[model samples]
Target chain A: MIRIENLSKSFTLHNQSGVVIPVMAGAHLAVQPGECVALTGQSGSGKSTLMRMIYGNYLAAGGSIMVGDVDVAKASPREIIRLRRETLGYVSQFLRVVPRVPTRTVVAEPLLALGIPSDQAHARAEHLLEQLNIPQRLWSLSPTTFSGGEQQRVNIARGFAHDYPALLLDEPTASLDAKNREVVLSLIEAAKARGAAIVGIFHDEAARDRVCDRTVDVTGFTPQRAA
Target chain B: MTQDQPLLSVRDLAKMYGGRIGCTDVSFDLWPGEVLGIVGESGSGKSTLLGCLSGQLAADRGQILYRGRDTRQMSEPERRLLSRTEWAFVHQNPRDGLRMGVSAGGNVGERLMAVGARHYGDIRETATDWLGRVEISAERIDDRPRQFSGGMQQRLQIARNLVTSPKLVFMDEPTGGLDVSVQARLLDLLRGLVRDMGLSVIIVTHDLAVARLLADRLMVMKDGHVIEHGLTDQVLDDPQAAYTQLLVSSVLQV
Candidate 1:
């Protein structure tokens, strides 16, 4: 469902004396629908930068990223935003719940962002939460009270609730214990079974082994390394 | 069961806020050059115990003794300096353990700088040495944490803590965000470092397997207290506490 060719990213760096040094270089990746791929590499291997390119968080310096016929690399800002909203989903390594937002509201925020009516959005979110077995008692409560595992579940619920055709998750199972990790993995599998194209950046080896059909080694893919 | 003064000691430690509980009647003495793994479910108060031991939070009751010195009796600045120079904590989120926007070198050297190391070249050299030891390339020294991978960021966190060579180290799920292979590598690195340095460590984790791998002794906590504590093999091989049994069985492969 997605195609990327010759994708490259770089940033200019400044030295101790304020001299600029350019870092990052041409990187490439391609992900298919109904498939899970694991990106493995050491730090500064450009794994995250590659994900950012696909997620449209960073503008690629060169090459093309096409998702279902839309050229994400060349798409206008509005077009990219729409594509991100309607066609793609992302779960960050850090759970990015807007502090102070209720769990129910955080779950429903995307639906509202998609311009669904408030009532309809709330109903959809509530229904999904019920299906996911989120307790009704905590529906209006902020996610801060929930533990890391609970917060991860909420993150998964939000990412998949929208039913986007393609999903991109960056290390979704990092915070979970073994049991909860299994649950989240099963959920991801269920999403794939429902025909959602999924690409995940993973750190947990067990999670990666369970969810991914293929692995892409990031070593030698880039020159970035922690000093 | 009291022996010669332990490096750190906790007795009947209880912390409660309002109706909420942190830990209850928690007691443990950490000996020199031993690794203690604290295992628990989320909200099991493992983190709170770490906070109490590190003096990040004052115990509502009970005494924390560091080499016979009552931590509660120490003045704020005294405790602060002790916590800074003699003890180190590695939090779950590397971001919490580090200044995210700072360069890797800066993150690794900050502790030294705080302890009054003023030579930029000396700090940079030390940072480089630690990074290399942690398997991080020196080229990325100037890059911000944002530019590193999750595993790299975690290693940077470790480098930062270990560079100070603190007598006692507290790690809360150091590999919580790493992949299996990376976790293995990091665990190996940590094990080796602890052995070579004879560093005392308390690692809090929910992963019983992880506990088995690194800890000489294991303590399983549920709710707010340690339900079981023993040698790692004894605890995992024959858990006396039902909670520990459940936890051990849950993570073991059939």
Candidate 2:
């Protein structure tokens, strides 16, 4: 369901006299439906860069990132948004929710964006929160003020609330306790069973081994050592 | 109309004032039930872009297609009718959009009347319902907007515009000039209403926070040019252009 070809990326340092730095070159990958692929690389390697390119956060130097029928690299802003809303989902390491929005609403937002009824969406959010061990009392509060671990768990809940056809997960099980990590790993397994194609960055080797069908090392994609 | 077709399509739209550019080469599509945000510093042509889209200002170049037909080709009365029915414009200053001399009920009732609702009782009843929706009390129906607080006036203006259930709405700083708490409340109400009503909105704001909260897609303008455009979270989180990066940094410069 997700495929990328001839992908390359470079960063232009405009403040430093417009110096363009080539990062990744000639990268390619594909993930079929019901498969989970892990992106693995050393620090500063193009692991996150490739992931960002797939998510369309970084404009590609040249390539096609096909998530379903839409080429994320070439899709217009609106098309990318539509693809994100209905086809693909991403869970970044950091939680970036609007301040003061209740955690329930934040978690339920994706389903709501799809025109799902509020009661149904909220129930699904609550179920995910409960599965991840978040306290019921905190459901009405904003996730911003939660602890780092709590915030990460909330982020995971939001990402998993919708059954997106394709998903990009960044360190989803990072910094979690053993029990919560198992919960997340099983969530990944369940997603795969339900036919989702997932690409993720996993630092936890055990979690990576347990959930990912294969690991694509990003070191080969880098053209030069990142400075 | 097909469900996937964009409700509004803007192509190479440009506007100029004698020797100066208002907005130039602006283009984007707004899908049904989508929210697009234009953000920039003052005089960056965000407001000019908004005015041209809402039919308040004529563009010097390009087409604004509302559901496949170019709106610029429409006659005056036809465009007026469209504005009164399918389109609504919310000004930065509520006073500019409101009928200050009229009662709150009359202000909202006027929009329904414009759409051919002639029965006085039904108009007043719908007007009262909309006032309640915007959190204005029914008893205040007869009070002129001149007496309402800034926040209340803005809410009443919203009721007036939305009472017609316009499919597409253009908002220029809908929360400008309100207190922080009041702005939050207004945004809350707006968010709920937009979702419930499936509104297609084009909002211009200098407040990145507001844009983040309400916008699905974002276009960053600088010196009358669109420097960057992307999903709201993507643009705000990892802005690529130099101008957008500077703007994002300043927002986080607490």
Candidate 3:
């Protein structure tokens, strides 16, 4: 389970006169095991910032984020990376799979980052990809050659390959066609069935309705004043 | 429809690079207010054909006539002027069509500022009006494209292209990256805009539903050839070519 309270983050923007303007503010969210939550908001609504905070990708400035016994808000850099590698799986809106790396290798990279043996990690990756319906012939090729829909599938496969109990997905279905959308969401459902806690940001209401166990509308959150 | 003085016309438009044909012998006409849809798969050369027609890519052999004048013979300045003033292109990724770091108003009003709109107040008003027409809120005019949702960014891209009132517009998978509900709303907005403005458009897509909703006529392409061309309903409901039939049949379930 994950809990967030009074979380706040801000970024400085330079004006024409070189004045810095701060944006972002206090936000709150929580996710529990086997529960899928949808984060919905307009661009710049701080949804991504909040997700990154949950992963300790950004240090929360104002409040506490508790993931089991770890306080993500106060965690050191090394501790955060270890927590991310061992306990969380994160996917971005933009699929940024490294080019020239084999799809299977990329899927297993997270395991490798955790110092898992190559042979064992790869075997696990192969099984996951097969279950996700990725063709065997394409497993050794870099994702660059794959189509948009295909690349997304590979990305999803990589995120869930390690079986990290908590998953965070940002706009995973944004670029897929209808058929691929169904496949990707089905994969998520399977992950849920296997007991992964998932939080995904979605611009598509229909996708949220279909896959999300709960929905949080962030449109009503008031923009906090800059300090 | 073909006309003696069509706004744009292409004949035998084929593009081949290193012996790989992009699109071969493709011909089409854009009257002042017509909407033509091009549908095909990834390797079917739909985007390549649009690139060739727009002069973004060179054709192996063809005639591109604008107002009865051959664009193939036009000077670089002339082509540039035509693109900036009379022709507009909409890319699938709005970021591709826009300068991301600039203000949304700047992105929409850049074409006008390029040719000669020096008055800042006038440009702002025009940009706001176009945004309003496209259903973007007034306050978002100052936000950068990066600060918009995928759907809002696409709408801003449309506003940017249409602000110039170009005689012809080319859209490549405008709704390709959006959500299903967003796609439906955008399709409705585009259909209404086209009818109300009497704009001429050429939309490239792989979705039959998109073709059905946004186009008056449809053309199916595959492996560098226009395999089928006819009224939208006819081509989709009852196709002539085996390729078009396969493409249409792929969309239906069971």
User: Whose lDDT is greatest here?
Assistant: 2
Cα RMSD (angstroms) for every candidate in the order listed: 24.5, 2.5, 24.9
lDDT of each: 0.78, 0.91, 0.79
Model 1 TM-score, 2 decimals: 0.52
Candidate 1 ranges beyond 4 A from true positions: A1-227, B1-4, B252-254
Model 2: C-alpha RMSD to truth?
Answer: 2.5
Q: For model 2, how does the per-residue alpha-carbon lDDT over B1-254 read when each residue is reduced to its tens digit? A: 87689899999999999889999999898898889999999999999999999889999999999999999999999999999999999888999999999999999999999999999999999999999999999999999999999999999999999999999999999998899779977887888889999899999999999998899889999888899988887788767898887798777543
TM-score of chain A of each: 0.85, 0.98, 0.86
How close is every model to the real structure, measured as TM-score? 0.52, 0.91, 0.52
DockQ of 2: 0.39
In the predicted model 2, the residue pairs found to clash are none
Which stretches of model 2 miss by more than 4 angstroms? Answer: A225-227, B136-147, B237-240
Q: For residue B251, give model 1's deviation from the true position in Å.
A: 2.0
TM-scores of chain B, in order: 0.95, 0.98, 0.95
Q: What are the runs in model 3 whose C-alpha is more than 4 Å off?
A: A1-227, B1-4
DockQ of each: 0.01, 0.39, 0.01
User: lDDT tens digits, residues B41-121, model 1?
Assistant: 999999998888888887899988888888999999998898788888888888898899899999988989999999999
Supply the global lDDT for candidate 1.
Answer: 0.78
Model 3 TM-score, all chains together: 0.52
